[model samples]
Structures are given as C-alpha cells and as structure tokens.
Target: MSTFQLPSSTATTSTAYSSDEEDTLPYPGELSRSDFLAKDFNPEAYLSSLGRNRHQTLEDLRSDLRSRSQLLNQELLELVNGNYEEFLSLGADLHEGEERVEGVRVGVMGFGREVGGVGKVVREREREMEGLLVEKRRIGGEVGVGRALLEVDARLGEMEEGLGIIDRDEDEGDGFDEDDEEVGGEKGSSPVLRRLQRHTREFLLLTRMVERVGSSHPFLLAQQGRVDAIRKTLLLDLAAALRQAKAAKEADAMLGIVRMFSDLGAEGEGVRVLRGS
Candidate 1:
C-alpha cells in the first residue's frame, strides 16, 4: 500500500509539528516590548531581580554607608569650626601680648631720658615692663600651638567632606546593576551613573592627597620656630629691664649718677637687649 498523504494534510501536519517544537523549547526571559510598555513596573523589584542576576547586593548597604559618611563629615566639620574659633581667640591674645610688649619697649626708651627726678619713676616702669615681656612670650607660644591645631582640623574636615561625596555616589550607583541587560526598550548605558562613579573616585583621591600633605606640613614647624624665637627675645628683654631698674636705684643713692649719665647712657644698652642683639 502506498501511504501517500494529501498535500493539504501534510502541510497542516508540518505546521503542527513546528508549533509543538516551539512550545517545548525553553524561552529565556528576554526583555520585550510588552515589558517596557507595562505601566505598573516596579522599579524596586526590577532592581532586586537585576541585582540577583548580577551578584550585586541590596541597596541597604549603600544607604547605610552613606548615612555613616554623612555623620562623620558633619562631626568633622564641627570640629574644624571649633578649631577656627580657637585660632581667632589665640590671635586676639597674641595681639594683646604684642601691644603689651610695645608698651614695655616705649617705657624703657622713655626712662633713659631721666627727666626731673624721674629716676625712681623709671625704676618702677622698668619693673612693670619686665612682667609684660614675660607675659608676651607665654602668649606667643600659645598662639603657635593654636595655629597648628587649626591647620590639622581644617585638613581633617576636608577629607571627611570628600568621603561623604564618595559615599553618596556609591549609594546612587548601587541602583543600577552592571550585568543587567537592558530590559524592554531601554536604550544605551546609564551616563549619569557612570559620571557619578568617576567623580567619586576623583574626590577620594584628592582627599587622600590633601591629608598626606597636611600630616607632614613644614609650615607649622616654621611657625613654631618663630614662636620660640619670640619667647627667647621676651625673656632677654625682661632681664634687661630688671637690670636697668636696679641700676637706677643705685644711681639714686649715689647722687653722682646724673640723669644724663644714668638715664640717657642706658638707652643704647636697653635698645640692644630688647632687640636680642
């Protein structure tokens, strides 16, 4: 028997077999136009599923990191601001001390003129001048310390701010999964996320560099040296003022030491001592 099938029946059979094969074949959940067109898409679910596929963790980690970074930055900024106020206070104290030093220098210069039995008065002025010079030295040292502290605080604040920015970028980037294929009709890679990551990396590097520079700063050392010099000068000036006062007392008793000889003569010596020569 010749088993010849009708042409129409054979065509139908081929179509049925093709359809069955297609139904049995596995269909990967590829993004389709229908998925994009769906209005009720859950972004959070999409992100989660995308993360699962890409091995990316949840967004909670990024959020926690960002919160911590912000807190740290805020605290550091407050510390820096506090240090600035302290610096200002130290500067004011230094200025006051400088004024006192200037007053002492003027009094010593004036005493050398020896006006109308002013020898006793000059001796009293010298004592006061000596005390002021000592105070000036102490205040100068305090100012130098304050300045160094302020510099360190400022650098720390800057580093914290940079870290905060980096953390924020990380949180934002965590939203997009790198391995997730474009779902639906979405076009191209995310430019915003890429830019954010780049910026964060740059900021982190800059902060680290600044911190390194600040930690081993030479300017702070130089300022400390200046403070030490000023302190030493103050000590020398105070010693000289006391000596002049003693000399004036001796001249008063001897009556032979005239105003010109005792007062005017000591002027050159006083100037030299005050200048730390």
Candidate 2:
C-alpha cells in the first residue's frame, strides 16, 4: 500500500508535449490526427470542403481541444478516486473467479457443438445439390437427342409426300454411256430430274448428321428403318432419272447423273444404267 501513490493531475496537465503536438505544425487543412482518423475520412476531399466551411478559426479549434482534454482528465481522475479502495483489494476479490471462467468455457463448448451440427447440414445439402445438377445435365442431353430425331422424322415425311409425283414410267429405255459431268455445270436440265437431285443431296446430308451422332445412338437406332427406306427411295429415283434422260436423248443429263452415282460410290447402280434396266 505504501508503494502505490495516485498521480498528480496538476503535474500531468503541466507536462510538456512532443514537438509534433504543437498547434503551429503544418497539416492538411490544419486538422488534428484524430479528425483524420475518423470514419469515412478523406483528407483530399475534406481539405477541398474546408474552403466552403472555414467558420471555425484556428484559435477556436485549439481552445475546444484544450477544454475537451481537461474534461477527459478530470473524469479519469474522479473514476480512479471513487474506486481506489476496491482497485487495491481486486486481487483478493478474485477467489471465486475460476468458477465463472469454467461457466464461460462450458457455454463456448455448447456453441461450438451447435456450429458443428450446422456445418454438417450445410455439407449434406451441398452434396445433394451437386447430384441434382449432374442429373439435370444428363436430361438436357437426352432432350437434345430427342429433338434431332424429330427433325429427321419431319424431313423424311416431306420426302414421302413428294415421291409419287416423279415420272417413273418413262424409265424403261436404252442405256446411256456412263460418262461423268457435274450436275452443277448443266442449265436447262429437266425439272423432274432437278428436284430428284436436290432431294438426294438433302437425304445424304441427313445421313451424315445421323452418322455423326453415332451408329449405336438409341434414338438413331430406333429410326434406322425409316431412314433406310428414305435412302432406298432416293436411289430408285436417281436410277429412274438416268433412264428418263436416255429416253429423251439428253446426252448431257445422262452424263451428269452418271457422275452423281460415281460420286456416291454406287458403281453397281451405274452398272445397271449401262445395262439398260
């Protein structure tokens, strides 16, 4: 008790400050460090704002700071004096403090258990979301395949509806020479032959798309019979067009259809053309 003495407030108030604490120091907007430390403080903008807000002179600012410092010192001194006896006996009063500490530890342990349970629920929900996302992607892929199959079916239907209009009767005639020329090079070709060539090209394009989808794709495999029937129909129309060209003695037209069969790698059909059937 003899070793401890209260600090003198008069001496504290009289203590000299560091050189930087002097009011004559140059600072941005002549503001104190406490003002610069304030929330949302922007020194550049605050300095700019000071031009329009210079109501408080430097002398007034210094007076207000000095008075606030004195008030804080007085309050601190009063607080210390009022609690001096209890502050001295603080070590003796901490005898039952360990029980309070144990109670706080138990509360923290209970809170940790609750947090752990919540974490487990969050992880479980994350796993479920991942599974649902994978299933959604799979269903989306199947839907895309189904739509492609519908397009193939629609095109085949159009080809079937147009099949009976082609002149199949005039195809029984003498065979033409199996010479080659591009169909693209000929103008003034027969309209019936032109339509047949266009449908053949379109059917081949559909075949390519189906092949790219894969041979064993379930959607393609299911429609394989209809696809094959359309292909056979295109081939028969091509054969008939070759004979009709021979009947009309359109030498250029026969040459173009012969070239088409060659490009198709169907030399057997070209052989039938040479055989007059």
Which candidate number would show the highest lDDT if scored against the true structure?
A: 2
The 10 consecutive residues of candidate 2 with the worst lDDT sum are 173-182
In model 2, which regions exceed 4 Å deviation? 1-104, 165-187, 217-219, 247-252, 262-265, 275-277
Candidate 2, residue 216: CA error in Å?
Answer: 3.2
Best by TM-score: 2
Per candidate, the number of residue pairs that clash is: 0, 0
Q: Candidate 1's C-alpha lDDT?
A: 0.51
Looking at model 2, residue 124 earns an lDDT score of 100
Residue-wise lDDT of candidate 1 within 168-255, one digit each (tens)? 4443433344545333212342332232233233334433543554534565444444333433333333344435545555433122
lDDT of all predictions: 0.51, 0.70
